[model samples]
Each structure stands twice: as C-alpha cells, then as structure tokens.
Target: MARSEEQFKKIRDQRYEEISNAALKIFARKGFAGTKISDITSSINLSHGLLYHYFKSKEEIYVALITNVLELFSQAVEEAESNNGTPYGKLRWLTELTFKGDFDVALDRHMLLMEAMQADFLSQDTKEQIIDQYTTALKGIGRIIAEGQQTGLFRDGDEMELAAYYISLSQGITLWNAKGLYPIRVSADMVLDPLMKRG
Candidate 1:
C-alpha cells in the first residue's frame, strides 16, 4: 500500500519531464527571453516554487532541452556505428533512425535558433558544447560515407560534405514538407542514384 523508492523516483522524473515538455511549448510560442517562470508554471498549473524544485533556472531547462536532443543525436551515431553491416546499410539505418521521429511537428527550428541567437544568457561554453556534439555526429556519418566510397558504393566527393548534404536535405524536407514524404524511408537509391560511384 506504500510507494517504493523506485516508484517515487519514477514519479519525480515523470513530473520533471512534464514540466520540461510544457515549458518547451511555451518557450516555442514566446521566445526564451520573452518567456517567464510564471508562463511555464501557469501553463502547467504548477506553482513557481514547485517548478524550481526540479529545475534551478529557466536557463537550466533550456540547456536540458539542448542536451536532450544532443543525446539523441549521439545515440543515432552510436547505433549506426554499432551496426555490424555494410557502410551503405549503416547509412540507410541512420537515415531511417534519425528521421523516424515526429520532428516536423515537435518543434520549430526557426524559433529555437532565434531564441539561441537572442539569449545573451546562453553561455559561450554552452554554444561550444552544442557545436562540438554536432561535429561529432557529422563525423560519424562522414566516416560511413567514406567507407562506402572506399568500397566503390558511393560517389567520389568530400565525405564530410556529403554527410552534411544528406542531413541538410532531410532537414529541409522535414521542415518544409511537414506532412509530405519524410525520411524518404531513407532510401539508398535516392542517394546512390545521384551520388553513387561512377565508373
């Protein structure tokens, strides 16, 4: 009839996630600086004090959001590398895995970028952290592309540039064609047809 320590921890983590999710929506609607603790609190009908019990500051919450996404990105890289398959196969897997999420409807890139650009409170270190993680992710993808090239499966181009283009194309499609063809199922032919190895 009593909750165990594990149960209590689960409940606490759930509540923390609830606050973060709600705050993100509000932050999206009204830029970060324009958002207030009260906005997040009122949106979730939680007291200001209660929210602070989980997060020390709004900046912390924003950082958590960024860190959360970065973790997902890292996972994608790990999953691709860990796959005991061909380079092309791994790249395809990465494509499907990365774009499988509901990113189009989840958050707006413009809003988040604007907030980051305008937030003076965002520390330089935080910006660097983001950049570093992003570069790592890119390299993971680039390595696969390079492997594919070495095996004569992919075209002869800059590995990093090709990887970046793949990401850019997927992002562009997801951002603009929210309800349209997405993940393109990460079809290998779509990539191969254009950038495949040529004799």
Candidate 2:
C-alpha cells in the first residue's frame, strides 16, 4: 500500500511538471491570449482530458506559471540576502540577478501573463495577490538599500524611492530587451554604475 501510494505521488508530480513545461513553451512562443489548451496538449503529446485533469483551464495554468516564476525570483532574492557580502555587494548581486542573470526560461511567458493581468483579464483577487507579492519582493530590496545607507555603502536617499527606481529600471530593461531596444547581453553592473554614482 505504501509503495502504491508513493508511485501515485510520483506520477502526479511528473504529470504536473510535464504540463508546466508544455505550458511554458506554448505561452512563450504565443502570448497568453494566443495560447490554447490544444496548443499545450500538442506540445506535451497529452490529451485535452489529461490537461484538464491537471488544470481546470488555461487561466489556471497561467496563474500557476506566474506564481511559480515569482516564487523562483523570491528564492533568488532570499539567497542573495543570506550571502556573506557587503551591503554594496549584496545590492550589486541583487541587481545582477534581477537583470542579466539566468532566470527561469519561462520568464518571457510570464511577461505575457503580466500583460494580460494588467489588461484586467485576470481576476481582481489574483491581481491583488500578484501586486502584494511584487510589493513584498520590492520591500525586501528596500530593506537592503536601507541597510546600505546605514552602513555608508550607498548614498543618502529615500530607500523606498531608490528601491522603486531599481525595480522600475529592471522591468524597463526587460520590456526594452523584448522590443529589441536594449541588448540582453549587457551586464546589470554596467547599467548600475552610472545610476549608483549619481550625486
């Protein structure tokens, strides 16, 4: 009985992973509005019934993808915070992670999901949840900036404002990179130097 239960759990986990991977590829290639359950099924070689068994609808899968992406980002920030580095180093590391570092390959897909959410396609509750998650993540960055100021590692300024600036800058880079206006090959360190050196 125990063995059977373990096998079932393993199969369930595997199915979920397969579905997520298929969804990532489809959503990245085609925006959320353009992706369909059939697209995911075709990518995964799964039946529509099987896909529906895992996710009630395409929107559910999108929400799950967004949640997973945010969790991965949060984990990166947490790991950077726990590292034994100077405040400036930590900030640099965080900036690099946010901008140039390798994140989940599904990030492009997640960007599409964000656009849909902003268009009011996602429910208000989900929108609020996403905003709260983003706010929490930014607050973590703000705390680091505040620490840097206290330790004389950063210039004197409003930590919240600086945090907001960095957050917006990171998002802008993503958008511009998507539009081919900015190169993804540029290091975040290169971008941060001028901004950090501002008087």
Instruction: Give the root-mean-square deviation of each candidate in angstroms.
Output: 3.0, 3.3
Off by over 4 Å in 1: 105-119, 179-194
User: Each prediction's TM-score against the native?
Assistant: 0.85, 0.79
For TM-score, the strongest prediction is 1
Tens digit of per-residue lDDT, candidate 1, span 17-114: 89978877777777787889998898878998888899999989888876776777778887898899998789778777655666643345434644
- Per-residue CA lDDT of model 2 for 118-171, tens digit only, reads 846788998888778777777787788788777766667887788778766776
Q: How many angstroms is residue 123 displaced in model 2 relative to the true structure, after the best TM-score fit?
A: 1.7
lDDT of each: 0.76, 0.74
